[model samples]
Target chain A: MTKTRRPNRAEVEPIRVATVMDVPGVIALDEEVTGLLKPAYWRDMFERYGARPGGSRVFLVAESDGRIDGFIIGEVRAWEFGSSPSGWVFAVQVRSRLRVQGLGSRLFEAVCESFRAAGVDRIRTMVAPDNTEIHSFFRSQGMMAGPFIELEMRLD
Target chain B: MRLQKATEIALYAVLELAIDPERQLTAVEIAERYGISTHHLAKVLRDLGRGGLVDSVRGVGGGYRFAGDAKRLTLMDVISLFEDVSADTDELPPQEAGQEIARGLRFVLTELDTQSVATLRSITISTMLKLIVRRPWATIALEPRRPTVRRGR
Candidate 1:
């Protein structure tokens, strides 16, 4: 009997900067996780972050067999609350069944590398109090409570 | 972890005054509305006063008014005054199942505690007031009105 070995993640999956053609795959992966179809939001994000001229904004994706298994988006923002310039990651998603294999972490690191290249010293992201999964992921990545406090008010 | 009664009362009193900074609410009025003890509420109010979170008004229509900045003062600021929000997992003893299980449980508990403290620190008094107003059943309005329970002084 002949044994067939499965390919390792690094060999099968490659992390790279997202292109315009990767938008649909990114949208599908996000929809699978959130259970909401938001093609327009993903396209808009691609235009604003992925297609921007400057390298300050980053949009990275992890691909396996030509499928986007994960994605992360972040940008450099400064002086919002008297703080210095820092990288702010606003979105990240990995396919549910394919999680726990470090794909999300790889995408996260790729974005961090982009931020580091952009001359930022710190990184920040906001997570809902109830989202323990994402919170745990960021915590594992050495993120903790930041100085800024988020407040909101309703107009209606 | 459950908040102490004093912490709950302090939150109510602070929110009452913070929602309308110009409005003043006596400890008795706040206690009556919440159906809690006036004496206990008075003590809590005194602590809040000492913390510089509220000011005691004198003369007619005198009561307690919020003194702290609503935008900057977070719920954790008020909660820390009455409760110990720190995660003390190190105090846990080893379980019969062994140190491994105990350590695992401690880690989970510590994570929960950290997240709770983070959530409290993120929400400001102003944000809480907005959330309250947005509730569908919160038709009672922001104005302080006399509750149905009438307690004699």
Candidate 2:
């Protein structure tokens, strides 16, 4: 008889990747994902872009406890990378139950590194003008958050 | 809406993977955890895999694993990794409602890329959580909308 041991929380580190197939997990991240839009849309993006090569897109995921906890979603456009193209982040989301952990940052770094490997030199993310959640992050990183806001209200 | 949907899924998937560092999750497992359709979840997972965010294992004891360390990762990088799924604003099939919303949300993605990695570095998972953990009924000051009673899961 032998005992099988599971890795302790400290010993188990978050896995980052260039891509993974965990739609349900990402879809469940938060309102940012589950409540933000529909599932069909995600399917469309993957079919169109993920299957294409040399387009400068990378999709990263973070997994813990055999579950998808958080993610950062974005892409690369040659025009943004340099004079040619670069990667940019579109959406960043994490599970509400898994907040206060370093999941978002992990996803963020994984995306940037993927771009670097592909020779992409730039990246970006659009944010709510008043989203102070990550305002200091952009300021500190020296990345410019274009002055803009999404004029939106729930269509009653 | 497609753009928003794309990222929303990407973020959640990454979070799922991050929290369960030691476990290897199947698309089905991830989907089940979220209570979404496994078929839909598989599509997103495949897209992420293609974008280089994840690698698929082909065996009884195999499943998806992170290609790198999560903390050193950045949202920009993850987006780029998953960019293929949400890459072009010009290529999506025409939908009036979707187009209208996408035209507006495009700014959000663009801002995401332009912002520096260091910008995200100073920020922590804690802060991101705080920002997004909105309780409009509890903390919102604007004319509050009628609250919907949601039963606990």
Candidate 3:
């Protein structure tokens, strides 16, 4: 009789380009993390990142057991806030139970690879100052403070 | 029902077409009017096209126009075109409810999901337009919210 070794969680899921099929899984993960159902927002994101014909955008998902457990979305833009061209990561979500298993890092690196291929040297993302977990994650990814600052006003 | 940003954009794009069924509005013009990303709006327009809610043309001066009967289109229809409207509760893992209160909270969440879908299905696009004139922001279309000309400094 032949015996096969069971794969670990990190080895179980393979990271791949996200498709329309992954949208529901992505939404479910986001809702579990953020407590909001933003399906419309995700649909728009999927179209821009998942369906784009060429460079400048990337959407990646880590799938296992026919379900998405982690995903990242990013795009390249120039001259925003008077800054030069850079890659901006708009969203990242990993299934809660699967954190620290290197799945999220793999997704991040996949998007970063796409950004680098698009000719952008810098990658940026906005995270609330108090979000220590995200801050630490970005820090681990070698992200630092950038030149631009976000400014907003309330008319009400 | 809380709408996704994409759904809201879809509604606006459809509304623009509804207000002028003959004019084929380019995604760029619509995005410019709202100060949103043209790239994103373009994708939304493409989805609307695929959903059979709008038709598109190619080459110079090409754009999109409403393809379906406006009065018959509901907000649910537009939203469903972009997203899966079902709650998809089966996707959620079974939660460990050790206490009665925890189970009650879970029930409330499920009820909220049901109510959200029900409300979205009830409102039609035409009925949503009727709500515009009643809102404070509606003054921009109904009347000149600002003076026609600024007074001499």
Candidate 4:
């Protein structure tokens, strides 16, 4: 019987801070997943999170074989609605075909390390109810319900 | 997450009508497509008509047409008409045993309810339509398929 060798994850895909050159890859990956092209939105995100020098905001991407497979964006928010400073992950995405291969988990851990370095003890994020994939991923990472409620009303 | 039969039917009817705002479909046609009861769908459609979400036509070949703005109409709006989406807490008479576990469970359930409501509120009919179109099977399921006729050998 022949045995298949398992590839080293770190050697196969490396997670690193995103640069200006990586903005296009991030945008393309996002569009591939969401089917929407919002170059301006992504450019603005890169400008605020990647280009800026603040350690509070972090934008990281996973690269494999010179292709961007995933990206995560988060920042440390303080005293928003009377809560203590915490890391808020606004967006995270991995290529659909490459999901469940631990890329998302690795990206999540990389961002969490950045958050810890920024001196935040807790992390927060909002996921849609129908987005079970993300919910399960967060749950696997030991995230549970937090002491907060989101309320909204429509205005014409 | 549970919805009343009326609410579910209303959602199907509304989405069907909204698929093409110009296309009018009778309650019977909508019910038939979904394999649901026409009588029940009629009641739901009547309520939707009162809600100003649909227009009922009176004469030959006339039916209900979507009147509400698909971009503005949300699943929560339609659901609120037939049922309350709020999470209601069960009052357990003061008991020492399992109190902590009960409190924790309640908190989790409340959080889930909050997330559900927010998700429903954020998703509009237009968004739902886009999602439906994006699904690989949706196109095949939604489009009318022509019947194949077998030729004599």
Maximum-lDDT candidate: 4
| Chain B TM-score, candidates in order | 0.81, 0.50, 0.74, 0.81
**CA lDDT, every prediction?**
0.82, 0.58, 0.76, 0.84
True-vs-predicted CA distance for residue A147, candidate 4, Å: 0.6
In angstroms, the error of model 4 at B15 is: 39
lDDT pick, better of 2 and 4:
4
Candidate 4 Cα outliers beyond 4 Å, as residue runs: A1-4, A8-11, B1-153
Query: What would the per-residue lDDT of candidate 1 be over residues A1-156, giving only the tens digit for each residue?
Result: 999998657434888888999999998988889999999999999999999735889998888677898889999888564578999999999888766566777787888888889999789999987665676567545565776667677999
Strongest candidate by DockQ: 2
- Cα lDDT tens digits, model 3, B1-153, are 567788879988988887767789899899988888888888899899999888998889989988876545666789888777665455334565555676666666876675456545544555455555445345436853443556886
Candidate 1 residue lDDT tens string, B1-153: 789999999999999899889999888889899999999999999999999999999888999999998866878899999988877755555365577877888887887897787667766776677667666245435635544657879
Using TM-score as the yardstick, the better of models 2 and 4 is 4
Give the share of true interchain contacts found in each model: 0.07, 0.11, 0.00, 0.07
Clashes of each: 0, 81, 0, 0
Count residue pairs with overlapping backbones in model 3: 0
Q: Mind giving the per-residue lDDT tens digits that candidate 3 earns over A1-156?
A: 899988667656898888898889989889998999999998988998898634788898898877788888889988654467888898888887887566777888888888889998779998764454565456445554554556577999
Which residue pairs show backbone clashes in model 3? none
CA shift at A66, candidate 2, in angstroms?
3.4
* Candidate 4 docking band: incorrect
Tell me the tens digit of each residue's lDDT in model 2 across B1-153.
233455566666766776555678887777778777677667777777786666778799777765545544555555555444333346545776678678767766655543433344444433333444544235435644556669999
Residue A87 in candidate 4, Cα distance off native in Å = 0.4
Instruction: Give one digit per residue, the lDDT tens place, for model 2 in A1-156.
Output: 899997543234475542437665665554454577556766665555454534566665567766766656567765521245667777666665554454555566677787888787667666554464555444323344432333556988
True-structure Cα RMSD, model 1: 21.6
